[model samples]
Target: MSSENDWNEDLFDCTNDCGTCFYGFCCAPCLFGSNAEKISEKNCCLMCCLYLVLSGVYLCWVPHYFERQKLREKYKLKSNPSCGDCPTTLLCSPCALCQEAREISSRENVRRIDFNGDNNQPVVSQPEATSDEVNHVDMRV
Candidate 1:
């Protein structure tokens, strides 16, 4: 029942992704930074610091709003008519962060913990076998 242009996950469907919801609830700025970095190759640490500082004055939503807009533009996702990015980010940043995190994770094909975890294991792909690698048996022997 959803369109291709819609977001992979809804803004309020935070519970749908428990990992992102829990991580975002614990440290929203970090999640925001991760989303920003993955969305447009921005610096995660710098963004996180900025978000932390702005959060004190209740303006953390500013960076998040811009990031959301960028994400929408990058993915061609549609915005709700009644509730747009500004209002959503200003009122419910946690949810927005979770939603963005989910989108980034899905689009980038990366895990949530990979954004902040140091012990990240690399995904090793198996090499394909070439024609010369196959062994041929003697049938006349």
Candidate 2:
């Protein structure tokens, strides 16, 4: 059974290929004992231990973090006219028009929306609206 200090030492050694190292020399004995082969496969070390600890912490705290991120993003509103500038705002949302526009923008067939062109419009389409909503319709006609 290796101690944490021994695992740390083994992990820091550049000579060993992590893929081939055994859990007994790489991970804490208690953790290795429960899942020896699995730990050995991953070459578990101080970094892996830290990653697991951090992931556990993240799992416990992610919901709150995500909620805060949502609020922050909402408050930090901007008229980002470029898909490249605001990828998260464009991609994550459930807007069909935005999805289609993204698809079009990706294609070589479609003309690129030049950011510095006379009309600095985003390639993304306007949000969908009901039949009565004329504001949603493009005025190109």
Candidate 3:
């Protein structure tokens, strides 16, 4: 009589076991573990594709479990301490969700530099008078 939440918890546990899991993308532990054969194809297929893609990338490019762990740990350390306001904290750090949120906030704060006259400030340019022209003008004055 396990609920969907129970299944999700099992999936998270299995994914966390290897330290290189795709978060909740893999099959539930109840399905992929010792009792794997009893699980349904629908549940397995729903989770497998995303996990396979992530695992493939991790195995090919990342290669080192320790390296990935280090990256995850570093992000956790650097992430904002106040999780009360940020819903993305649930995803932890170095994750796509957290990175995307950070990128958006950063972009929002960035100021656009204006080189043309469109900005509110007045544009100032030096008068193109040569030194001789300035001297002659001064003498005439």
Candidate 4:
């Protein structure tokens, strides 16, 4: 088995994805619910309501901490020593949610296709190759 890996995104790297950062900051409960649902297939509405109720009483970070823990275990990610899960959720809830959202989205196999106006067809472009990468072809004569 391979060793555990660090989080795909850094906690302070919230600005990396503008949309997720905005969503996390603007509506934490919705983002938390979405992350919970994605991680455990839980009901988004129920999770959202739970987060809302918890936030009302000033215990909003509890669910996010648990969800973050779950995400770490599921992905075999290393734990943060400087800022633990509970503290991260408690102190930087929006950023934590943004990180989780970024992590989850990064793992999903989403592809973007562009439309060609000339032929009216969808074009799937390959990633640009780096200098170190070699294009191998088998020649049959």
User: Across residues 47-90, which tens digit of lDDT does each residue of candidate 1 receive?
Assistant: 99999999999999998999999999887889978899999999
- CA lDDT scores, all candidates in order: 0.86, 0.32, 0.32, 0.87
RMSD to truth, every model:
10.1, 23.7, 19.5, 12.2
Which regions of candidate 2 are displaced past 4 Å?
Answer: 1-51, 55-59, 62-71, 74-113, 121-141
Full-model lDDT, candidate 1: 0.86
Query: In candidate 1, which residue pairs get closer than 3 Å at backbone N, Cα or C atoms, i.e. clash?
Result: none
Question: Candidate 3: lDDT over CA atoms?
Answer: 0.32
Count: clashes, candidate 4: 0
List runs of model 3 lying over 4 Å from the truth: 1-52, 55-78, 82-102, 105-111, 115-141
Colliding pairs, model 4: none
Q: 6-117, model 3: which lDDT tens digit per residue? A: 1111212332334223422233222222111112123544333433455454431122223223333433323334432133322332232223223323333443433456
lDDT of 4 by residue, 10-97 (tens): 9989889999999998999999999999998899999999999999988989988898989998889989998899889999998989
Report model 1's TM-score to 2 decimal places: 0.74
Return the TM-score for each candidate structure.
Answer: 0.74, 0.16, 0.19, 0.75
Q: How far in Å is the alpha carbon of 69 misplaced in model 4?
A: 0.8
| Model 3 pairs whose backbones collide | none
